[model samples]
Every structure is written in structure tokens, then in C-alpha cells.
Target chain A: MEKLFYFSDLFGVAVFSITGALMAGRKSMDLFGVLVIAVITALGGGTLRDAILDNHPVAWIRDDTYILVATLAAVGTVLWVRLTRPINETGLLVADAFGLAVFTVIGTEIALQHDTPVSAAVIMGVMTGVAGGVMRDVLCNEIPMIFQKEIYATACIAGSLVFIGLLELGVAAWIATCLSMATVLLARLAAIRWRLSLPRFHLLDRI
Target chain B: MEKLFYFSDLFGVAVFSITGALMAGRKSMDLFGVLVIAVITALGGGTLRDAILDNHPVAWIRDDTYILVATLAAVGTVLWVRLTRPINETGLLVADAFGLAVFTVIGTEIALQHDTPVSAAVIMGVMTGVAGGVMRDVLCNEIPMIFQKEIYATACIAGSLVFIGLLELGVAAWIATCLSMATVLLARLAAIRWRLSLPRFHLLDRI
Candidate 1:
């Protein structure tokens, strides 16, 4: 189970690093900026999770492999973009959604392992899923996607609940994880394809 | 002692909020963005402090006054900027240094109150002092000052050590706190004026 979990984490890290590099590339940032974003995108979620859980030494600090993978992924992304002029934004978004789905479930599982309450686990899962991308956006000098026009965090929340429900029903951990990922991925892609958006509450406008 | 400590916290929050609003104004962000940065800058240190200590109901969540003050500070800054054209960036940076100095001491004091080790307290203090600015930078889409050039976190770390040293010498808390704050402020300003930067390890390139 632990081995499977580690593999899943590696997969998520690679996908997220690619997304980060692609986002930074869109802004025509320097190589250093691209690598910084990639590192943040890959490690930001797990860092938050460990910090909140008081699981000290953070995940990346504990193992250097995550950083290694993210660096490779980032270099690979830059090379791919250089080779193929005009990177595909939509394809990167899709990859990001898939990464988000896997990360959310994995984060929830880790929180659960730490004996956090179900509600806290769910929230942590959503936070872990979206924080990386949010950090990437923030570093890239753009409004976070969470506060913008996509059901990003909402989908993570929904998928987390699905994972919890499956656990309650005695489903195997791997199966539940897969279902949760699929739900978030499908929801995100559908939202993107159909242009779905939550209502913006402009409390500032009224004041 | 408690009264002085509380006063310092209030002063720090107000000054930090002003600094945040000033940065937002420099970037020509809207009122909402300005307010967001102000709140984050004001509450950021305490939030990280409480989180590291694993305290429940985070400091800002428990005390509404902090949030209220930050909000008012942001509003006041917006009005001031609108009525009075461009503000002095140099002046704002000085205020930020003072804010960072005060918050570093306050954060260390809180950690000590929680019975944390002196080393942990020092680290927590530096984290508190720097985390808010880092978050603000992330939100505004700029490289965190700590990660780039500046004596930002270094100043906080030095101050925290001084604070701990003074406390160990049976120095009065108020005197120690004031001295520590002054240390951080002077060090930070000097670094900024001199364009100080730590050696960036090119270990990543080797990887």
C-alpha cells in the first residue's frame, strides 16, 4: 500500500511540475523562474499538509526524490515547448486537472491516516489539491484560478466526499482513490468544456 | 508586560497593513486586491505562529479585532493614496522593516509562552516575520522577497537569536523585545540600502 501511495505521489508531482512549467512558459519567464514555479507546484501541497499536521521536516525535506522528479519534469517541459512552438494551454489544463484529482484523494488519505476528523480531512484534501496551482498562479503574477472562473476547489471538495463515502461503504482504498480521481477529472473537464462557473460574490462592490 | 506586548502587536499589524496597501497601490491593483494583501500581511505572522504551535482556532479567527484593524488600515490607505497621489516607496519600506522587527519579537514571545524550545521559538519568530510578506508576494504575483535578494529572513533570524540571548541573561522582557526589534529593523534597512544578497547555491544546476 505504501509503495502504491509513493508511486501515485510521484505521478502527481510530475504532472504538477509540467503544469507549472507550462504556466511559467506562457509568461515567457526565464529558466530560473520556470524551475522555481515547478518546484513550488510539486511541493507546495505536501508542504501545507505536513505543516498543518505538524508532521515536521516537511515531505520534500524528508526525501529529495520529489524535488528530483519535479526538476526533471520541468526541464522536460521546457524542452518540449521549445521543440514544439506554441504550447497547448488546454492540454496542460487537462493534465493539471488529472493531477489535482489524484493529489486531492491522496491528501485526504494522508490526513485520515493522521487521525484528523473527516471534515478536516476533506478540507485538507481540497487545500492540498488546489494550493500548488494557486501558488503557481500567484508566482506567475496572476489571480489564482480558485478565485477565478473554474469549479476547481469545488470539484476537489466533491471528489473528497466521494472518497469518504466509498470508505464508509467498505470499498478498497485503491478503488476509492481511483473513483475520487475520476470524479474530479471528469468534473473539471466538463466544467472547462461547458464553461461552467460559480457565481461571484462581489461583497466589495456592495460596500 | 502583557499590555506592552499587545500594543506592539497592534502597532505591527497597522504598520504591516500600511506597507501591504502601499505595495498594492504601487502595482495599481483594485481596492479588493489592496485589502486582501493588507489582511494577509497583517495576520500572516500570527497565523504561521499559531499553526506551527498547533493552536486551535487560529489567532485571527479567535480575535476579530486584528482583522477589523487590518480592514480599516487598507481602507484608509486606499483613501490616502487616492487623495494624495503617489506615496514614497522608501518610506513604506522603512515602515515594513519596523513592522517585521516588532512581529519577530512578538512571535518568539508567543512561542515561548507555549513552552516551545528556544531554537523552535527563534525559528517560529523568523517564520512569522517573513511568512506574511511571502504570502503577500505570492498573492500579488511577485517573487517572495525572502527567496530573492534582501536580508529579510536573515534579519529576523538574527533578531530572534538576540531576543533569546537577552532572555537568557535575565534581561527584562520589554528591554529585550525592544532591542531585538531594533536589531531586526536596523539590519533589514541596512541590507536593503546595501542591496545585500545571500550566495545562491547552484546545486540545482548540478542536479
Candidate 2:
């Protein structure tokens, strides 16, 4: 079970790192900038989860492998994107969706381990899935997609509920995790395909 | 001593909030964005410190007044800057310097209260002084000023050391806090004037 979880984490890291490197490439940043964004995107979400839980020796600092994998993935992506100008945006979105799904489940699992309530776990899951992308967007000087596109966080929340429901139904941990990831991926992809958006409050108009 | 520290924290929040609003104005962000950035810049560092320490009911969350003041300051600054198109960049810099000094001391003091080691406290102090700006820059989609500029973090480090040394010498808390803040302000202003930079590692080349 633990090994399965670890593998999922590694997969998520690679996907997020590639996405981050692609973002940097879009900006035509130097190699250093690409590496920085990639590493941050891969590790930022988990780091926040650990810190909030007061888990000592943050995830990346404890396991150097995560950093190593992210760096390699980032460098490779940068080179690939450079060699092949105009990488497919659709492909990147699919990868990002996969990363978001995996990370949301992992984050919820970690929060549950810490004995956080279901509500807290759901919030943490959304935070974990979105934070890395938010950090990447901020570094790239773009408005975070999370704030503008409510579907991003909304998908994570939906997945968290599915995970909790599966657990209540006595489903095995692995099965529950897989189902949660699938839910998030499906929801996110659907939203993107249909351009679904939450109702904007438009406080400005009210004022 | 606690009273003085609270006062310093209040002042720091106001100063940083103003600076954040000013930066938002420069970017031509809407008033809502300006307010968000201001509150984030003012409270972000302390919120991070508290979260890392696992202090429940985050500082700003517990004390609504802090959020109110930061919001008011942000709104006022945005309106002021809008009315006065030719903003005074120099004045904002000076206020930011003062904010850095005060925030550094407040952060170090909080760490000390938690009985953290001197080295840890120093690191926390620097994090508290700079994390908000890093966050602001990230949200603005720019490389964090901390990564680009040397003097910013350097000044915090120097001030933290002075704070620790004063404690070792049995200096009064209020006096030590004042001296440390002064040191930070002076070092930061000088660095900005002289354009100091750390030697870039350029790890990519080695790799």
C-alpha cells in the first residue's frame, strides 16, 4: 500500500514538473528559471501540507529523490519544448489534470493521517492540488487560474467527497484512491472542454 | 515589551500593506486585486510563521482587526494612488524598509517565545520579513524580488544576528528590538542604493 502511494506521488511530481517547465518555456525564461518553477510546482503543494501539519523535515528535504526526478523532468521538458516550438497545449492540460487528481487524493490522505476532519481534509486536498499551479502562475506573473477559473478547485472538492464516500462504503484504500483521482480528472477535463465556470460574484458591480 | 512588539507589528502591517497597494497600482490591477495584495503582503509572513508553528486559529484569523486595518490601508492607498497618478516610488521604498525591519524583529521574537533555537529563529525572522514580498511577487507573476535581489534577505539575516547577540548580552528587549530594526533598515537602504547581489550559483552549468 505504501509503495503504491509512493509511486503515485512520484508520478504526480513528474507530471507537475513537466507542466511547470512548459509554463516557463512559454515565458521564454532561462534554464535557471525553468528549473526553479519546475521544482516549486512539484513540491510546493506537499510542502504546504507538511508545514501546516507540522510534519518535520518537509517532504522534498527528506527524500531527495523527488527533487532529483523533478529536476530531470523539468530539464527534459524545457529541452523538448525548445527543440519543438509550440508544444501542444491540449497535451499539457491533460497532464495537469492528471497531476491535480493524484495530488488531491494524496493531500487528503495525508490530512486524514493527521486526524483532520473530513471538511478540513477536503479543503486541504483542494489547497494541495491547486497551490503548486498557483505558485507557478504567480512566478510567471499571471493571475492564478484557481482564482479565475473556479472549476479547478471545484474538481478537487468533488474528488475529496468521493474519496470520503468510498471510505464510508468500506472500499479498500487503493480502490478509493483510484476512484477519487478518476473523479477529479473527469470533472476537470469536462469543465475545460465545456468552459464551465462558477458564477462570478461581481462585488464591483454591487458596490 | 509585549506592548512594544505589538505596536511594531501594527506599524509593519500598515507599511507593508501600503507598499503592496502601491505595487498593485503600478501593475494597473483593479481595486479588488490591490486590496487582496495589500492584505496578503501585510499578514502573509505572520500567518506563515503561525502555521509552521501549528498555532491554531491563525493570527489574522483570530484577530479580525488586523485584517480590517490592512484592508482599509489597501483601499486608501489604491484610491490615493488612483487620484495621484505620479506615485512617489521613493517614499514607498522607505516605508517598505521600515516594514522589513519591524517584521524581522517581530518574527524573531515569536520564534524565541516558542523556544526555537537561535539559528531557527533567525531563519524564521528572515522568512517572516520576506515571505510576504515573495508571495506578492509570485501573485503578480514576477520573479520574487528576494531571488533577484541580494540585499533584501541579507539585511534580515544581519538584523536577526544582532537581535540574538543583544539577547545574549542581556540587553533590554525593547532596546535590542530598536537596534536590530535600525540595523535592518540601514542595511536594506544601503543595499538598494548600492545594488548589492549575491553571486549566482548557476548550478545548471555544473549539471
Candidate 3:
């Protein structure tokens, strides 16, 4: 069970790293910059979650796999972009949403392990799902996706709630995880496909 | 001695929160946004530091004063801005630098407590000093001050090294801290006064 969870986490890291490399490439960041954003985008939110929960040494520092996966993914993305046709935007969205869903479940479970209250646990899950991309976008000098009327964080929140609700109803851990991840992934896909988004709050209109 | 340090830490939090609020005002963010940015600007770096070090319960969570000071600072800045004339930019710089210098020393000491090596400690110190402001500027969708040609992070690094070096020489802790903070503050002020800056790295030209 632990092995399976670890594999899913690495998969999340890999896909997010690729998305990060894409952003870095678009920004004309050097190879080093590309790698830095890759690591941050893949690890930033989980790192934040662990830190906020006071989980020691952070996952990446304690285990080298996360960094290795992120690096390989980043390098691969850079090479692929240079050698092949441009990446399809839809493909990137699917990969990104998959990563987000995986991260949300992982974050919620970690929060629960630390005995955080249910509300805070769900918040941590969303933070875990959204913060890495937010950090990546910020580093690229763009608005964070969570603050941009995107359906991203909301999907994570809904999924986390479902995960916790199921656990309370005696669902098996793996089953709960899969269902919750599906919830987030499907919601995000629908949002992307239908151009659905929450209303953006803007003070500029009044001013 | 510990009480004095706590007071200074809170002072840093207060000043930085004010700077954050001022930035929020300029960006036309709503009141909630103003408070959020203020808290992040004041506490974000130290929170990152403690989390990285695996220091549990984080400083702010251990005590309520930091949040209280930050909130008061943010609310006060907003009121001051709306009720009085605009904040003097020079004054803001002084206050911001004060927070940065103090935070650098505090972060360095904490890293040493965790037994990090000298080089890593200096890096941690710089992260503590500059990260909050960097987060603030990024949230405002602007280039971070440290990443610009500014001497900000350099000043923090220099000061942190000084702090550690003096401590290794058997200097009293308080004196080492005061001298180090003075070093950063003075260096930053000089950079501001003389308009000293480093050359920026631009890949666009080479590419």
C-alpha cells in the first residue's frame, strides 16, 4: 500500500515538472531556471504542507526520488519541446489536472495523519493541490491560478471533502483515495472543456 | 534575553506587515487581500525557514503576538494611507530594510540551532530576509526586488555571514546579532542612497 502511494506521488511530481518546464520554456528561462521551476512546481505545495504541519526534513530532502523524478521530467520536457512538435495545450491541461488530483488526496491524507481538524485538513489538501502551480506561475511573473477565477482549487476542495466524508463512512483507504482523485480530475476536466470558471473579483471596476 | 529577541521579531513582523499593506493598497486589493498580503509579507519567510528546518509548531503558531502585530500593522497602514497622504516611499524603504535585517539574523540563529552548516545558514538567512518581500511582489504580479538588479539579498547574505563569523569568534550572542543587523541595514541604505545595483542577466539578448 505504501509503495503504491509513493508511486502515485512520483507520478504527480513527474507530470507537474513537465508543466513547469513548459512554463519555463515559454518564459525563455535558461536550463537552470527550467530545472528550478520544475522542482518548485512539483514540490512547492507538498513542501509547504509538510512544513505547515511541521513534518520533518520534508519529503524531497528525506527521500531523493521526488527530486530525481522532477529533474528527469523537466529534462525530458525540454528535450521533447526542442526536438518535437509544440506541445498540445489540451494535453498539458490533462496532465496538469491529473497531477492536481493526485496531490490533493496526498495532502489530505498527510494532514489527517498529523491530526489536524477536518476543515484545516481540507484546506491543506487544496493548498497542496494548488500551491505548487501558484508558485510556478508567480515565479514566471503571472497571476497565480488559484486567484484567477480558475476551477482548480475548488475542485481540490470538493475532492478533499469527499475523501474525508467517505473515510467517516468506513470506506477503504485506497478506494477513498481513488474516488476522491477521480472527483477532482473529472471536475477539472469539465471546467476546462466547458470554459467554466467562477466570477473574478475585481476592484478596478469600482475604482 | 529571549524576551528581547521576541520583541524584535515582532517588531520586524509589524514593519513588514505595514509594507505589505502599503503594497496592497497601491495594487487596489480589497481589505481581505490587504490583510492576507500583510500576513504573508510579515510571516512568510520565517514560516518557510522553520518548516525547512523541521522546527515544529512554527514560531507564529507557538505564540499569538506575531499575528496580532502583523494584523495591527496592516490595519494601521490601511487607515494611515486612506486618512493621511500617501506613504513616503523613502520611509517605507527604511522600515522594510529594518524588517529584512532583523529577520536575516533571526533566521540565521534558528538555522544554527538546527545545526546547519555555515554556508547553508547564510543561505537560510538570506531566504528569511528577502522571501517575504519577494512573495509580496510576486502576488502583486511584479518582478521580485531580490531578483531584480538590487543588492537586497546580497546585503542579507553578507550580514548573516558576519553574524556567524562573529559568533564563531566567541562574540556574545546579542552583540553579534546587533552588529549583523546593523551591517545589513547600513549596506541596504547605502545601496539605496548611491543607487548601487548589479548587472541583470538577460537571456533575451543572447538568444
Cα lDDT over the full model 2: 0.81
* Candidate 1 TM-score for chain A: 0.90
- Using lDDT, rank the candidates from best to worst: 3, 2, 1
Off by over 4 Å in 1: A1-4, B1-47, B51-109, B114-207
The candidate, 1 or 2, that scores higher on lDDT is 2
lDDT of 2 by residue, B33-117 (tens): 5666787789888879888766655555445567777878887776664454555667777888988998898889889989999
* Tens-digit lDDT track of model 2 for A1-207: 789778778888998999888888889898999999999999998888777666679888898999999999998887776687666779878888988998999888887777766666775687688788878887787877565663777788899999988998999988999999999999999988998866432222211
- DockQ comparisons of all candidates to the true complex: 0.11, 0.11, 0.17
**What are the iRMS values of all candidates?**
7.6, 7.1, 5.0
Model 1 lDDT per residue over A74-164, tens place: 9998998778777677987787788888889988988778776666677578868877877898777796656555577778888999999
Summarize candidate 3's per-residue lDDT along A63-102 as a digit string, tens digits.
Answer: 9989999999999999988898778889888988888899
Candidate 3 at residue B19, lDDT? 78
TM-score of 2: 0.59
| Candidate that scores best on lDDT | 3
Model 2, residue B64: distance off in Å is: 16
What would the per-residue lDDT of candidate 3 be over residues B17-57, giving only the tens digit for each residue?
Answer: 98777776667665655766888899889888877787877
Q: After superposition, how far is residue A177 of candidate 1 from its true place, in Å?
A: 1.5
**Which portions of model 3 show Cα errors greater than 4 Å?**
A1-47, A56-126, A129-133, A139-141, A148-207, B30-32, B199-207
Candidate 3 residue-wise lDDT at A134: 80
